[model samples]
Structures are given as structure tokens and as C-alpha cells.
Target: MVTANKKKIGLLMVLPAIILFIIMTIYPFAYMIYASFTDLDLSKANTGKIIGLRNYLDIFKDQLAISSIEFTALMVLIAVPVEMVLGLALSYLIRNLIGEKILRALFLIPMMVPAAVGGFGWKMLFNFIFGPVNYFLNLFGIQSIEWFGRPGSARIAVLIVEIWQWAPFVFLILYAALQALPRDILDAGKVDGAGGWKLFLHIELPLLRPIFYVTLLLRVIDVLRTFDIVYMTTYGGPGSATSTWSFYAYKVTVSYGWNIGYGSALCVILIIVSAILINTLTKVLNIGRELGLSKE
Candidate 1:
């Protein structure tokens, strides 16, 4: 009875946070779902009358919307894998090396800085004129390039910035997982004449699988909804070169006058995509448990 009373008090203490989550997250999401089925454009003082599935249909038919989705998908495909691979390599190197405390801190500096500052810093690095990158290129007799003025270059620039900012997170997580690995197993492998590459491939890599997937899923969701870095550097410019769904939505709602209904529809679609990805990941992890590969 005493334990039960303590549990009740603990629940009461957390109730305020639960209530706020419902009010701030659940309520706004529900409201967006309702708003998505309306015709709430600017220049009209209406709360938007219901327009059924027209907004969704139009979204599918809109070339710009299709293009933005494709661009975002492509970015996730490229940036996430590269970041993961680089981060894993860094983690492994640090794990096996001496005097790593400073190196680890240096790696994490990128993640610690503000996103806007990092984005602008990268932008300056790739600037066509008076930038260190161009100056280095000129040393090899290579022509100066317009990094953000072209579509291809703009995409490349944003991908670089994303990789730089988020790769540190992957490294940090993987390093923690490495520390938690069974020391006896690694020591036994070392004694059995296992080379570094072979040991990593046949042992360490398998053990790191769960962490890898978790990191991959997290980075995918983050990159999909990414806006600030791209917005600060390119503003989705050069003919919608680096335009992601989030940036496009912001443009339609805030910058280009209010199309609250359409913007809300975009938000709904993004929510649906995120939900689907989360559910799929959950199923994958459940399968891992059923196969005796991972803990719940």
C-alpha cells in the first residue's frame, strides 16, 4: 500500500508534462489534419471551408511538390549513408587509438555549434570568390566554381553541410556502443591472431548492428525534415535547387503570403511520411527481437 501510494504520487508529478505534450503536440497535429482539407488561402478572411481531398490531389499533381519530395529523398539517401560510414570509421579509429580524448572533443565541436552558424560558415568556405576552397583549387590550376549559384552545386553544398553537422552525432553514439561492447570478446579475438580489419568485419561490425540502425533511422528522420542549414545558406534558391519539403512549405506559408490550407496539407503529408517510417522501423526492431538478435 505504501509503494502504491508512492507510485500514485510519482504519476501525479509527471501529469503536467503529459498534459503539455497533448496540448502542444497532439492538439496542433489534430488541428493541422483538419486544416489540410480546406481552402484557406491568403487575401481571404475565412477559417477555410472544407474542400475534401482537393489539396492532396493537387499536391500530387504539382510539379514543384513532386520535385521537392524527390530532392529531399535523394539527399537522405546520399547524406545519411556517407555520414554513417565516416562516423563509424572515426569511431573505430578512436576506439583503437591512444590519446583520443582531445580528438573526440574536436569531432564533437561541429555538432555543438549552432546550425545557422555552421551553414553560413560552409557557405563562405565554398564561396566562388575570396574563399579558401577556391584559392586551394586555383593552386592546382582548377577554375573557380560557383557553389550555390547552380542547381547541382547547391545540392552538393547542402549535402556537405548536413554531413558535417550530423556525422558527429553518429560518432558519439557509436563510440558509446563501442565502450559497452564485451571486453572479453575483443580480448579473445586479439589473442586468437585476428587482424584489425578481420576482427572489425567478423566481430565488432556485427555487434554494432543495432546502434547502426538506430543511428541511421534517427539521421534519416532528421535529414528529411531539415530546413535551417539549407535555408540559411541557400534559401532553396537557384531555381529550387536545394528545396526540401519543409523549406517549400515555409516559403508557401510565410514568405509568399499565407496559403495556410495548402501549407497545412503539406504538413499533414510530412506527418504521414514520418509516421510510416517510424512504424516501419518499429516493425524491423520487433523482427530483430523475434529472431533473438536484439532486446526489446
Candidate 2:
């Protein structure tokens, strides 16, 4: 009887939270899904009427949407690999350094700064007239080049800011993974004539595979949804060279057009693409585990 009463009390305690979740998260998500099938302009939000898959169909025909998708894919492909390689190398180098803790803390400063603040700071650094970048180039007899004024430069600027701000996060995760590795296995490998690159390539890397996959997955999702830096620095200007999918959706919803329904459709598409990518990565991680690559 006492156990039964405790179970009932526990259920009662969680009931309110469950109700709140349904109201706040589940309901809003369902509503958004519904809205994606309609014409929900902010001008007449209350008069939204269902238009089936028209909104979804329209997105493929939208050139800006296509461009944003391409740019976002490119950013993820380039930035994630660059960050992963740099982070792994830095973590390995710093692990054997004096004052390693202090060094780690210093590296984490970029991650600690607010995104908007970092974006604004980078914007100033990349400014055309008074920016230090242009000043340095001028000292070399190079003419002032616009960092955000041209399409290629604008894309490069976004990639630079993103890598600078987020590489520290990847480094921290990888460093922790490296530190937590089993010393017994490493000592065994060393005794078995496994040293330097041979030991790392065969043992350390296999153990770190799981953490690496997790970090890559997270960075991919983040780069896909990137908006703040682009908004602050370029505003998707110079012919939408740096507009990610999330930024494109924002432009449609609030910046350029007030088409909420279409924006919701874009959000849905983004969600779908992210889900598929995450699912595929999870499968790859599982495969790695099954092949005896991942430790735990």
C-alpha cells in the first residue's frame, strides 16, 4: 500500500510538467506544422487557410532558398573538417605542455563570449576603412580589399568568424576525450612496439571516434542553423553569398517578406534535412562501434 501510494504521488508530481510540455512545446510544434500548409501572412494571421503542400512545393522553385541551401552545405563541409583537424592537433599538442590547464582556459575564451558580441567584434576587424585587416594589407603595398563587399570575400569572412568562435568548443571536447582514454591500453601498445603515429593511428584515434562523430554532428547542425553572425556582419548582402538556410527563413518571415506560412515551411524543411543527416550519422557511428572502432 505504501509503495502504491508513492507511485501515485510520483505520477502526480510529474503530471504538471507533462501538461506544460504538451502546451508549450508539443502544441506549438503541431501548430507550426499545420501553419506550414497554409497561407499565414502576418498581415492576416487570423485568416490563414490551408493550401496543402503548396508552400513546400514553392520552396524548391525559390532561387534564394536554393542558394541558401548550397551555401549552408558548403559552410558545413568546409568549417566542420577544418575545426576538427585544428582542434585535434591543438588538443594533442597542449596535452603535453606546461600549464596545460591555463592554456585550455585561455582557448575557451572565444567560446565564452556571447555570439552577437563576437560577431560585432569580427565585423569591426573586417571593416573596409579603419579595420586592422586592411591596415595590415596596406603596409604590404596591397590595395584595400573589401572583406564583406564581394561574394567570395563575404563567404570567407563568415567561415573565418565561425571557425574562430567554435574551434575552441571542439578542442575542449576532444581534449577531454583524449585525457579520459585508458592508460593501460596505451601502455600495452607502447610495450608492443607501437609508438608515435602508429600508436595514435591504430589505438587513440579508434577510441576517439565516437566523440569525434558527436562533435561533427553537432557542428553540422549548428552551421546549418547559423544566423546571428551572418545577420550582424553581412545581413546576407553582396548577393546572398553568405545567407544560410536559417537566415533565409528569417528574411522571408520578418526581414523582407511577412510570409509566416512560407517561413514555417522552410523551417519544416530544415528540420527534415537535419533529421535525415543526424539519422545517417547515428548509423555511421553505430557501424563504427560494431567494427570495434569506438570503445564506449
- Identify the leading candidate in terms of lDDT: 2
Q: Model 1, 20: alpha-carbon shift in Å?
A: 2.3
Off by over 4 Å in 1: 2-15, 281-296
- After the best TM-score superposition of candidate 1, give how far the Cα of residue 138 lies from its true spot, in angstroms: 1.3
Q: Give the per-residue lDDT digits (tens) of candidate 2, residues 1-296.
A: 57988999999999999999999999989988999999999866475899999999999999999989999998989988999998988888897689999999999999999988999999999999999989999999999889999999999999999999899999999999999999999999999999888988999998888788888888988988999989988999789889999999999999988898999999999999999988898786684564466676
Clashes of 2: 0
**Top model number, TM-score:** 2
Q: Given candidate 2, what's the lDDT at residue 199?
A: 86
Could you tell me the lDDT of residue 125 within candidate 2?
A: 93
C-alpha RMSD of each candidate structure in angstroms: 2.6, 2.5
Residue 165, candidate 1: Cα error in Å is 0.8
Q: For candidate 1, what is the TM-score?
A: 0.91
TM-score of each candidate structure, all chains considered together: 0.91, 0.92
